[model samples]
Target: MWRCALPPLPRYPTVDELGARAAALVARHPRDARLRRVGTSRAGTPLWLLSVGHGSRQALVVAGPHANEPVGGATVLRLAERALADPRLCEGADATWNLLLCLDPDGARRNEAWLSGPYTLGNYFRHFFRPGFLEQPEWLPEGADGATLPETRALLDLQDELRPFLQCSLHGVDVGGAFLELTRELPGIAQRVARTANRLGIPRELGPYDTLYWPTLGPAVYRIPPPRRGDLAAAITEAAVESTWFHPHPYGTVTAVVEAPMWGVAAVEDPTPPADADAALRTVSHTLRDDTRLLEEILARVRPLLGCSPDVARLLAPVDDYLLVGPGLADSWDPDLRQGGTRPLPPLTVARLTALRLAGRRVALRTAGLLHQLVTASGHDPRGVLPELDRLIDEWCADYRDGCGARWIPVARQVEYQARVVLAVFDLAERDARVRSRSGETGWGSPAAVPMHRE
Candidate 1:
């Protein structure tokens, strides 16, 4: 067992760095703890799962399921520490805690530049990476058993073996504020989460993104509509072909997707509806529509350039294709307005729109950069189009960052919020129809405050 080395706790660690830390902890407590190779990432990085506590009812908490969303790595590790220190954290409900530090190591390696950081907005946006829609874990495959990506298959295999009663996917954004996605709601879960998140200094997402399209049970909590057949493909292609092979994990398991922004923008937390709430929301819709239109315009310029270079087309066209797809929020929310009086744009609507647009542009810009490389590598000489596209993308990125002046969401807060939510949700499930989640409590200490041993 290697001792913890190379850095202090609470820092954003590389996939290897994090793996070492987890291994070191298991090394410390050999009886109740052991580390196992669940699977390997596409890039051939070993996927590690640290199991602490021996219980019948299983809970699997996955962090960095997506390569770019590594913020949860620390959160999952912290939870493992707590469980190890005080086994009671996993004592009830026969819950054996299996913490998967990150399932997507290949993409995570791409994000390592910003993982350990000054945690600045500029660094994050510059090094930002997210797997393409079809490449993600939960959303990647049509069914549970057959998965193209080794990472997905590994996770699906673990679930088959453990059939976790609860699954928590920890994810964070480079911009915007915190939000929660519930596959199914457990009573009293929302209030407990909101209170804990607030106490830990993380604000709920006030942006229109989650609120605009998804239904919220309470502040910042959105019920993610599970995908049916073809919904995954439809996400990319506007066309709906029946996805007969698709189905999310069955109803018995409860899952929570914790999405918190790396930098907490206080403005996003404000509940005061902007004075022109109605117009503000319409503007938000307009921004997405306009951005999508611009994305298509940019893609058109580059698509013709890729024809002869199937190498380039194979490598770069799908990225351009994704950008060509419309941002669906505009259409998804149109019905809400039809039933309404203009409610104030949720406090973070504009900021959310700004961040969302920025994320889209960043991906497009990366697409442009890769296209430029493909052009040069393919030996396509005299044409100057790719360079022009690169310059255009860089200019847009600079302008967007400068205009927003976004703050970095502190790493501590990000971890604590996620840790609390995972524990809270698991505790709720343990009660399993026992203790009713009561209202009226707006601050710290829920049934989740199971005595966790701290190091």
Candidate 2:
């Protein structure tokens, strides 16, 4: 087995640094690996694709298309290293696989500083605020002039050229527990994937946890709704049609955008865990393998079912609501912490509530902490928590509408906002309980804590 020396974990890396690291890795393992500069970012950073493996005809294309979600980038890098060292992983596969590690170097680099340091819940919270272009790297194929971004253009070019059987776009979510999204229907794969997670002691949940779980593509192949229009899921289906020019392949390409929760992968605790790189690596390895197996199973079962005649557009639809929201809350609760300064109350409130429920803080203390966070961070009045939360939500929506300049802001914001709102609610509940206890009205036991939604 060829084991490359593991680089020490840093909080983050600059865009240039990330590019250098990627280039070096490609250079060091050139025998089975080749690096291609697919395109340049809006910021003019070169987006590179690293490919490793012998020619097997069938290809598995995985890209960490988002900037904030670096776990996919890490996972891809690890996979590349593993593929170079272990011939079996590539050998056993029936088809050739070309994995595109990161498609958004500019966005990826904007948040690189956070990746280099010791992993922390606070660090994760802080990393999300850095603003990149409005267009998601993954969705850029549709483009700026309604055309793809440079990165997306590169992927599209490769997709047109290689016409691989499977494409897995790597992404990470903050709130949901871990789950898999499939392009085509795979009857028994979700259970198997869940089982793998359970075996690895990774937290797993099924069904849409929040709005983020909703469909970005067409209909739900594995879950619900047949399919829809627009988004990556839709775009990939469109791309598949052009596959005819590239090859006379028997099966149409099965493209999946896999989203794994960052917290689950890193095993982030409510109170937070001490940094442990080995444990983090183990978690990632298990997750990648579990996901890979699930994908392989789905491909094996569905390849025969895919046909060009009656286009399986519905087969490529999203199964869950992509918006992440709580029962009674809007989705714009938290401030994008990457902008620095004290982030508003929503995320802090949620953190306190989660800490109290999961980390075993006393209700009174949790409530007090919630109040403290709100008062200190958001400059909101402690006495009017509900009104403050409501106002914050309204302000956030207005800001989002103004900033996005689009009809609809991305649904992931809902999940982000909901997490913040729920945290605040939990914190407030804890605080209320404390007040009730002091006044001697013991009516309710405690608020039932709900798990963050994931699809």
Candidate 3:
């Protein structure tokens, strides 16, 4: 982490509050900070990019890439404030900082109800909103629907214009612990991140998550998986063409995707291998299938009444994807084996499996809640299905609470952990640049051939 200290944030901000903070930075440092209207959201909200410093190289920091993961919004504002106040931050990194306040303002606005939070599990799901994969700005496949979201176009435009050597996208999870995905393996940085989380008493997420399939560099650190055309229909894969794959540089841009959990669960931190490994996998798989069927039945009842509401469709896409894709992709895993017939999974694998199972339950409950919201918003008497959905949501929520014993992580700590990881990545980039300079190679994309693991 850098010398500048970030005070813990009390709460996540709304999209407008994030914008206001960005504007305040420009006001405070008018000579150094330049706020640009890069593009407009689908809702016609102006998207702002706050550019600070005039270093020879450039670094892009994107917050709110996933709407519900708003911790990054506060993280971005704080980092911008620090960059403006302490010019050495950009000077040391030798890169200009371009911070995008929020990528998906439309989706972020939908989640505003929970942003200023009491920070409870129930309160979060009640107002939660995640767009369908296609509806997402950066992840949407090229020409899949013959159109691109304005927000996505803006991102592409910015990438082309800036051609940053380093990019960090801020993201977080609802529960579990913190994890990171890096495009290029930077030695010592991942260990530093783990140490930072440990120092803050935040357990590194060892469980299965969206990027479970990616290659691991160390504990809670992963190399981002390359895009595959075949993964398009997979429920767990989410998108075949992720935002990280669109770098403009020829060699490669070092991209870091930081995921901090809002709630901490002990189950995911345990590294002890499970005894009945096959049975555990089977149970997780079985529960996912059963829940998918249950949600399918619920959606069937309201399919006719909803009248093709795009918002409802987007809201239900995750559940729908699970139902359509079968017990494959996101939900399926084979046991590890040696020359011996079969081996017990590693402790981290077991923890991930447990987390994945519990995550399925959360997805089911969230889907039910969204369904109830849709029915009520449509002016229909939802009593017919809501009572059942409510009961399921309550029972599943209870199961989630009891199963994982997840504790609400304070927003302040979450921001601090994220900020530390970002700064670590920045420091790694700076160190790599110096190494390249010493080696007489001044290319933007070619990071010095640093070892993947270095203490």
Candidate 4:
């Protein structure tokens, strides 16, 4: 948090609105704010970067790295506004601020329907639009395929040019609670972040989800360790992070990721489970296998339905390919990873898994929706899937609400929690820099994770 009274959290802006506001800052504060076009998005919307303060060191805050996570944009706008109004925001902190307000404008635009209020579980899942894990701009490749997305190139170019000392990529998730992913355990960072989150009443989600495949620092905070070559599939781990600018810094850059959830489950932080340990694991494993088979069946039904239409065929390819890859990945997880390790599973963890499944279903529904859009635009419904798909979506949404009733964190508080964690990371980075100047050694005081409890 800044050292002054802050304004009320601004309304969550639409992609277009965020861009317009970014541009507006330049005109409003000609002396303190300057805007530059980084590159154009896939849809030819100009990607803008706003700079406030002209300090010796640089700190880059990238918001809305993924399409569905517009809360990041709110954090960036507030940071930029504060830095401009009071240069001391970064004056003693020894850094200039570079804000990439909304990285994926085109995709974020697709989510504008839920960008503002009515921030509930049902409304969010209904309007969600996250690109495939590997297809994200934050981790896209530098080769021709990744180069196709102008947003990726813009981030790559900016990262290469600035070589920032501290980088914060803003991201949000739909469930469990607030969690963070960072490069390493920077000294004082965890405690500072904990304090901020506590003050804001954000329940720290002791991970049983994101930490399933990654290393964790403490409660609610996980570390994105450098990937080992054979840790898992190159596609899932390596290719997915080909151009993340935070890593490989000569001196480690204090990078942080805030994954604020749209909902909170107190059970997520508890270490107890409602069912027998082995029974829970078996059930989770069984459900994943069954769902994978179900997805395959849906794919089989969908593919031949689009037989002759090349355009609709293209629209369905992602769902088709994902069906092929998804099953194998689900099978690879051991029973422990599927559920919890040897320990009984909690209902909140189950809800987390359900949320993930809901995400997959929505994505498939989107592909089907796109097919409908294409067919309708062509004045035909060769596949006749619109009504069927609509029914399926409704059934899934109703089931989700029934399962996780009234367990949501509002839009405003989500932004507050994320912003507070980011500021704490920045503060930690400055402290570390000063430490290095005197003792010439890094000391984050974080020990190697032994996983004392099952995540």
Write down the TM-score of every candidate: 0.76, 0.50, 0.88, 0.80
In candidate 2, position 320 carries an lDDT of 11
- Our tally of clashes for model 2 stands at 48
Give the residue spans of candidate 2 off by over 4 A: 1-18, 58-60, 130-134, 140-145, 209-251, 265-455
Query: What is the per-residue lDDT of model 4 for residues 114-134, given as tens digits with 9 covering 90 to 100?
Result: 777686645565566656554
Best by lDDT: 3
**Which ranges of candidate 4 are over 4 A from the true structure?**
1-11, 117-123, 140-148, 229-234, 237-241, 245-248, 304-318, 333-388, 439-455
**Candidate 4 local lDDT, residue 441:** 48
Give per-residue lDDT, candidate 3, residue 369.
70
Residues 167-286 of candidate 1 have per-residue lDDT tens digits of: 788888655667777766777877887798779777566553434555667767777665545554255432122111122234245667778777655555566534654565465555
lDDT of 3 by residue, 1-455 (tens): 44433344589988888877778767877887899999999889988998898786778899998888999999887788678677678776567888998899999998888888877777787677877667777674654234388888888778656766678999988878888888778889778988999898887877556655667788888887665554555523534564534444333357888888898877786778778777776666677667767877888888778866677677667556545554453244434222254423344456777677766666666677777677766787543887777787777766767777878888888988998899888888767757765786543533332222212
Per-candidate local distance difference test: 0.63, 0.40, 0.73, 0.62
Please give the ranking of all candidate structures by lDDT, highest first, separated by commas.
3, 1, 4, 2
Per-residue alpha-carbon lDDT of candidate 2 for residues 160-213, written as tens digits (9 for 90 to 100):
566454455555554334444544344444545445444544443232222222
Which residue pairs show backbone clashes in model 3?
207-352, 208-352
Supply the global lDDT for candidate 3. Answer: 0.73
lDDT of 1: 0.63
Pairing residues by index, what is the TM-score of model 4? 0.80
Provide the lDDT at 135 for model 3: 70
TM-score, ranked from best to worst? 3, 4, 1, 2
